[model samples]
Target chain A: NAGVTQTPKFRILKIGQSMTLQCTQDMNHNYMYWYRQDPGMGLKLIYYSVGAGITDKGEVPNGYNVSRSTTEDFPLRLELAAPSQTSVYFCASSDITWRTEAFFGQGTRLTVV
Target chain B: EDQVTQSPEALRLQEGESSSLNCSYTVSGLRGLFWYRQDPGKGPEFLFTLYSAGEEKEKERLKATLTKKESFLHITAPKPEDSATYLCAVQVESGGNQFYFGTGTSLTVIP
Candidate 1:
């Protein structure tokens, strides 16, 4: 079903630059999430949306913003990027039923220098 | 605060050896506990989901068991191809289905 897909598998950003990480899912999931995984650490939530046009901040949403314009796409935006934002970003989607597991896309590796 | 902790951080074993990875969690209300395997340069792949205590699920050489306060991912007769990082996550009943993840346990199976 192609599950979930992410764009720009790797990127390097200059300090203060801005960029967006794209995520798309064809599973018709109502829930979408963005997370960042640092080396030697667990994945931390950045932002999430329950459905289209709905978005909310997550545990570590300081430098990130997100928008869910459609049921199939949720994009994470980084404004004024900092070195602390360097990590691997993952996008996941799941059905509303809690019993279903979230499916993840191939991560995007971001480096801020 | 909701939290998930996994141990022993990393493990190395012979191909035939078997072991278990632990995930302990503390949250106001637990909706579900999940296990995933991640290879280098790739996102995590789902393995199992336990919704209640005493529930157990199995896939190939891996079995996941859940308790009131913890979950265990047991690997049986591991092979070198099983080497990867295992991650645990807990979804809370509150807070819009936010998931708390643990620092994964890196497994190395040597042939």
Candidate 2:
């Protein structure tokens, strides 16, 4: 099964432009997360969803928004893309149980000009 | 606030040498700790999960141990293929599944 899948493997955005990053999982996991990794930096949590229709912010959520309408899809939206927003975004999923293994997508590299 | 910190931002080891990586965290109630190995341009891959203090888990050449405030990943007789960025993360029991990650320790095993 395709564990976790993300669309638009790469993208280049102009300032103030907006786009959505799509993430889907076939494992029927209840925990989904969005994280951004800058060059040589650790992954920063942007948003997370515990289940469908329940979304919450993490450490860094200034320029990002997320919605969980279905259990299989968790999409992140970038508003007013900034050069600082340029980074590799990753979508991850895991079971509801604690300390479980997490599945990750290939990642979407976004470069904002 | 919850946070995670890793030591030795970069590391170099010989093919037969062994070393330990550190991961420290600050959380009111830590539920679990996770270890991951990430290659350049690839997402982090799950390694081991530690649930309680004084707990240890092993796989192949890697061993992970956990305490109340920190964890360690010990690699024994590492090979060049083990060269990658090793990441440690924490999940707190605060009614959520969000993970806080460290900057990661870049390990390079030379032959």
Alpha-carbon local distance difference test for all models: 0.93, 0.93
TM-score of 1: 0.98
Docking class of 2: medium
Extract clashing residue pairs from model 2: none
What lDDT tens digits, residue by residue, belong to model 1 across residues B1-111?
788999989999999999999999998888899999999999999999999999999999999999999999999999999999999999888746667799999999999
lDDT of candidate 1 over A1-113, digit per residue (tens): 69999998999999999999999999999999999999888999999999999999988999899999999999999999999999999999989887678899999999999
DockQ, computed on Cα atoms, for candidate 1: 0.80
Query: Per-residue lDDT of A1-113 in model 2, one digit per residue for the tens?
Result: 78999999999999999999999999999999999998668999999999999999888999999999999999999989999999999999999988787888989999999
